[model samples]
Target: MKKRLSLALLPVLMPLLHACTTVGPDYHVPAHAAVHAPQANGPLLGTKHPAVSLAPVPDAWWRLYDDPKLDKLVRESLTANTDLRVAAANLRRAIAMYHEVEADNLPQASVSAATARTQISGESFLMKEKIPVFSIGDVGFSVSYLVDFFGKLERADEAALASAEASQAALDMARVGVVAETVRAYVQGCAATHEYEVAERQLALQERGVDIARKMVAAGRGQPVDALRAQAQAETLRASLPHFKAEQEKAAYRLAVMLGKPPAALPAAEAECHEEPRLRQAIPVGDGAALLKRRPDVRQAERELASATAKIGVATADLYPSVSIGASAGLTGLLSDLGTGQTAHWALGPMLTWNLPTNGVRPRIHRMEAGADAALANFDGVVHKALQETQSALSAYTKELERNLALRAARDNASEAARQNRLLYQAGRAPYLSSLDADRTLAGSDAAVAASDSEVAIDQINLFLALGGGWQNSPDVTK
Candidate 1:
């Protein structure tokens, strides 16, 4: 009898013993991905310039400008930005979903209790005895554990964990974006104010020229047309003032919004800024290897690929049979006999369920394989894009710095020419029109220089953004 009982239990024990046989392919990083190339281990192609250093980028790159106001605004935006709050909530949700999937690895249990009145018919028993109404009571407890003989639950856990990590990376990306944009708005506001001041100075010079031209005409030393020409130039310069003023106001409004405040709430000191922030030292930009590690978009894509790979395993596990072991104990009888030995019952067994091959399991496996292929492609694309953006930003900044140098020189030459022409006119050796023309050229040159200054500041900010340094020191939103 013992031998017979042992044989009887073999069927149930066999599946548990085979629980180590996990189905589907395990995940490995694709060898052909761009991050593995030898070039990625060295300095970036665009870093061979005097304006940038080969040192590792700092976490808070904005501090290189040494602008206390910019640093304060970045910190405030990180804490209060609405987009960051949404990203934080998404991360929390993904973590909760992972926990929900992870719980499936443990046994499931349930308890039930019920009481009801019931009647038995005499005809059903084929006897002349009448059955009286009675009260029935039942209490049950059951536990079931899915024997992961094919690793379905294990794959599910992996996929969920990867998804949670991807969400975390996404939050990091958001922080990077918020920090970059906050810095951008601040720089733009200051740059616009500088341009406005430059334009105002030009307008004042032109107005003074108009007064001198009128005085010369009254003293019979200059033509009425010269005064008219000077007046027209002055009006033209005055007209440009509003546009610069509008740009300053627009930038201030953007900065205010980025800080999570009303547009009108912008500080007077912030709007009064006339000097754009500039870096005193070369910007530190690490290499491609570091960029791959630092950029949150790259991390997010890699995590997504991991999640998709695990999902393929989950789908592949569906091709095999699923096994679950369940045990239950209960008491069910008339209320008067409840809890007695005669009413007690218990059962234990292993259950097997298979979705047969004809039930569309192969197609699901194919779908998952296709999804993994797509994820691999996306990972490659993201890596390439990171490299491209960083290199492009570096090129733009270097070229703009060169352009700014030329503009400053041109402004200086125009200033000298305007001074010489004014001296000649005062000595009665040059026409009023000649001096007037020189002054206009000088005004144009100064405006060009001002605009170039703004562009250079913007380009520097773009390069920092592409380097992806700001998110490293960001506050953890998950806590």
Candidate 2:
């Protein structure tokens, strides 16, 4: 019995100690590029963006929007989005798969039953034999387990665990994206509202100009063509008012949908959207190493990679002999009715299955290796993409800041010029046309400044997405 025990278990136990030696390189996450990583680049005293401002994004970062309406929308979207439901289902599936893999490493027992009724016709074969009716039923439970003389099952379970983690991260990533898009749509809605107001202001000024030109033409001081030109300008400005208002309304509806509501169903604004999204003026992006850790895509990529690495072990295990043992008991009847205890059978011995004689195992090893390679490349791709996202976000935010400064300067100059022109008109030194031109230019500058403010806000939100925004507080959909 001792010898038998040793024979059955020795092969499995030895290989387990060296489970790490399957074939190709064992997986470990590769290092990040040294360009921005201070760990790789060595410490710098007083770096570009201070660590304090570079805090990891907090969960529920949307509260920074300072708009209760936005908070409600994000919460509503999270609960109602169909895509989130799908992600939840996928997570459950991964959990089930993990359970299945874990089960393989434990003892498996199965109970089965079979009943047979047979009738035979024979003439010359058995003339002396009595044509007796017979019936049989068999039932038994068999248990078997192949101890992990190898880490095959363990590795498979590890891979499955990683897969589950990856699924979770993917879900989180989706949540982040959905929330960002909803915020983006809200910002757009708010910008549209501001644009409509600007159009209204312009239209009012154009109407005043038309009245001026009409009076001048009636007094015979201006030609009929001047009245026509002023009327055309007023009509043109009026046309834009309708268009801008329509656009703003559509933006509001889109925001409602993103909040998971019928556009019309959402509460109407007694007041227009007043969202002020506060973000760090100077964006402080962390180094690549830390950045990689924050990215969900990076986490998901690593999980897939671990799974591919484990498949090699699974395929390699198939190359060796698979052994089994079994025992069973049953009953059969002839003259009398015999049910459960009428018959019995049992056996216990090494049942060896050797498939190494075939060349199938080598091909599978190659396939898994190729898969592992692909996964590594994929992981590498995500890393670079995340780096680029962070860099691009910060770079864009910087440009938007500069643009805002330029816009402000232009606005200041335009306001001063319009004031001087109005003074000159009052003093009878400037023609009415000069005053009208100055007013028009000043209005244009004011509108431009409004648009630039919205742009800066929009770009800052984008920076939030790229930097990985977190939820500040869960949105209260009930509100």
Error of 1 at 129 (Å): 8.9
Q: All candidates: CA RMSD in angstroms?
A: 2.5, 4.6
lDDT (10s digit) by residue, model 1, range 306-341: 989998889888887777878899999999999999
TM-score of 1: 0.94
**Candidate 2 positional error at 436, Å:** 3.1
lDDT of 1 at 176: 90
Candidate 1 error regions (>4 Å)? 1-9, 12-16, 118-133, 270-272
- Cα displacement (angstroms), candidate 2, residue 98, comes to 1.2
TM-score of 2: 0.84
